[model samples]
Target: MIPLRAGTVTEVAVLGAHCDDIAIGMGATLLTLARARPGLRVRALVLSGAGTERAEEERRALDAFCPGAELDLTILDLPDGRAPAHWDRIKNALAAFRAGARPDLVFAPQRGDAHQDHRVLAELVPTEFRDHLVLGFEILKWEADTPAPTVFHPLTPELAAEKAQLLLKHYPSQAHRDWFDEQAFTGLTRMRGVQCHAAHAEAFVLDKAVIDFGGS
Candidate 1:
């Protein structure tokens, strides 16, 4: 894997349309990053599920995923599956998040996501984080919406297992969903690993990246 030579990301911004989107998409990647860099700054924003059980679930889930980091998370009350209708509020939230800190990396839903809420947030993230490295994470669901990921974060077998267990443990609200299970999570990561010649992996779709081939 070609590494990002951005000189060690101290802060990262994670944007999600719903509670478990980030965890479902990139939980292993977050664990890997946090373990590599203690005290990494993680600022997360979820558009929906504020003042609900889902929001609480997300707060605890992120804590598990981002171990040893200073996590700054905000759960907004935007209605689920209605991001297009509340464009202004979402934009304002993104603007406020951008103004607070210039994160070295950003994670958000990919533009091709079939869900409208995911698609809208994916479209909006680039507008706010113009110059930062933005990795668009894919969430597998009932619809066929997986993109050809250009980037891959290879997860070790242990990390892959940890991610699945953490998801199952923290997000009890999602346990009722048919897709929320260990097999589905591990199977997808294993498939992604095959693409990158690893035991497991979390992939991402990114539009642009500046490579520094000068050294090493």
Candidate 2:
């Protein structure tokens, strides 16, 4: 187990296996980070595959959600549903990120997820970046057991609503599924809010926070 702490954070590197993962997982936190810290740069990467044209859909979706921060996105054109199949490609991607830029903060999915892609991403991230602060975002599902988040942020009802609208409206293929319905989105937010004793909030599974305890 890793002890967690909070400190000044500026940069963010968001890694996802599909288009909607980042938005559905940690969209509000990304929103909060941008607003709190001016001139913060976000690097959003998608280990995309051919499942549903994920390469293009997410690029436009992110543009709509985070309007101010121009997305420094890297769309990895790896085979979808085949992330585990190509170990070399995944490693190369992680190595390239480390070799180029080191973000102060990292956000990815948790290992408890029901989705195979999400689980693999969770495993891959820790193996690559060992020292930076990492937060795991939740994706609602029947298998989302023991959801624990020590770092929580309240999202305005309007912001939460807008996020759902973005997820549903921007990704038309997703809205066709009932899971992306307004009720479903609201209910998940409500549940997380209840856990954190807030009206509405986004939760992050915190780990390995690199904070300077000494007075600076």
Candidate 3:
């Protein structure tokens, strides 16, 4: 288990392209923070909020997963599958949103994701959160794009199960989608667990050297 120095996440900023992306990519991390530092405040920001059942579930699931935490989820109603084309609007809007506040940590999609929307959102995060420590998270989907993850988070099989359960239970609209299954998430953790020599694990690829070994 790579203990994260996410810096006592009293302030956190999470950005996503659509919905449920945050929950899927970093749900267990949220659970860990929510339990570890009960007072840590969290905020989720989405570029757009379109009227889809999938979108609605994300709102509800986030509340369920992190009850009483400050959550500012902004789902930009920009057309799905067109994030790259709207770069100026997204960059300016994210800049405006992040102007006064500097979060302790920023979690967003990996820039190398094969998904177009994810890639666009990933690019926008660095532009706005220029100084905050940024960590790229992966989502298992049709692409199954697994980049070389340098940071690994160890979770109990139970914690992994709970994370998966939250994903399955809270995001009902996405139930039809097979990957939303707890089993799939659990399976990936199992595989990652092997790499980290743990019972379960979630891996992340850092874009830069936030800190060297032992805060060197």
Please provide, for model 1 over 50-141, each residue's C-alpha lDDT reduced to its tens digit, 9 standing for 90 to 100.
99999999999999999999999999999998999999999999999899877989999999999999999999999999998999999978
lDDT of 1: 0.92
Runs in model 1 lying further than 4 Å from the true structure: 1-6
**Candidate 3 per-residue lDDT over residues 1-216, each given as its tens digit:** 446555556878887887888888888888887777766677777776666676688788887767657666666687778888998988887887787456788888998999898899898888878877888888888896887887888889898998899888877767787667878999988888898999988877788764567663
lDDT scores in order: 0.92, 0.75, 0.80
Error of 2 at 150 (Å): 2.7
Lowest lDDT sum, 10 consecutive residues, model 3, at: 1-10
Q: Could you estimate the TM-score for every candidate? A: 0.96, 0.87, 0.90
Per-model clash counts, in order, read 0, 1, 5
**lDDT-sorted candidate list, best first:** 1, 3, 2
Q: Candidate 2 lDDT, tens digit per residue, 5-118?
A: 445766688888877889888777777777677667788878874445565678777776666774688877776667778777887887787666668888888767767777
Better of 1 and 3 by TM-score: 1
Report the C-alpha displacement of residue 116, candidate 3, in angstroms. Answer: 0.5
